[model samples]
Target: MNDALPREIHAVLIPVGSVRLLLPNAIVAEIAPLSGLEKVERAPAWLLGRMPWRDDTIPLVSFSLLTDANAQEDVRTARVAVLKTLADDDEMPHIGLLAHGLPRLITITPDLLVRTDGGERLARGTSAHVLVRSDQAIIPDLHWIEARIAQALPA
Candidate 1:
């Protein structure tokens, strides 16, 4: 077993289906209950829609949808996690992550993590290591998420 102690990640546990995801606190800006979102025509299926946030409107994507998990049946009960992402130069945009249920703050222990195996992966594929609790908590690749937004949105 690796002797390295796990760094405690102050994360927000966003429940999606039976799984609870530990998202880095730094990335999370705010969490809001499901609300009005302006649907974009011809947008990707994964894109939930757009909503007014702070000053500018932000695009939202279902976390389950992004991971290719089951589509949420209770959109009314779902919540949106606003994530701060660096844009052109040094601007930060608040992008929303649509997830089922609510968010909880938790501490992750070293023993609860495992190194990922080298092989085929899924959409939103995790890194070489993941933090697990009652369910597997894959450490997300923000760069991957950012790239997806870059491909879809204009500067």
Candidate 2:
């Protein structure tokens, strides 16, 4: 067996309502518990609210909104996945994903990742749709999502 392959990447499997989000461990800053959030006026449905994260107000988004599903759980029991922004803008360095529960860690190899659905159409906020360990998940388009947030922000 050749021993030149790179090490398996560590990732976080977070549940956003019914949909799962597979995110690189390096991109996720923290999984913080949800508290009272500061709601923004005239914001889109996906933009739940802003919460204090690392001395900044980060926008918390709902995955269900992107897919037209309802998975919003009890607010008192919700958690937020704090992710580092992929865009070049600094005004919003980090964004939060509303997770229904705690996120679990997983190690992944290239061979284990597979794209199904015959190249399913990826909507906005979605990048790639793949199956991880037989479970389907959508790799969010962080860059696109951030761009949407940037446009949604008030002047």
TM of each candidate vs. truth? 0.76, 0.88
Candidate 2, residues 1-155: lDDT per residue as tens digits?
Answer: 88886669899889887778899999999999887699989998888888998788899888778556454445667799999988765788899988887787889899888877577676767888888898788788887788778887786
Q: List the residue pairs that clash in candidate 1.
A: none
Q: Stretches of candidate 1 above 4 Å error?
A: 1-6, 69-73, 86-92, 116-120, 128-131
> lDDT tens digits, residues 1-155, model 1?
89975578677777755556667787789887667788877666667778888777888876566666565535677788898875542433677877776678777667755655445564573443354666556566666776675566545
lDDT (CA) for every model shown? 0.68, 0.83
lDDT of 2 at 73: 48
Task: Name every residue pair that clashes in candidate 2.
Answer: none
Please state the error at residue 15 of candidate 1 in Å.
1.2
- The TM-score between candidate 1 and the true structure equals 0.76
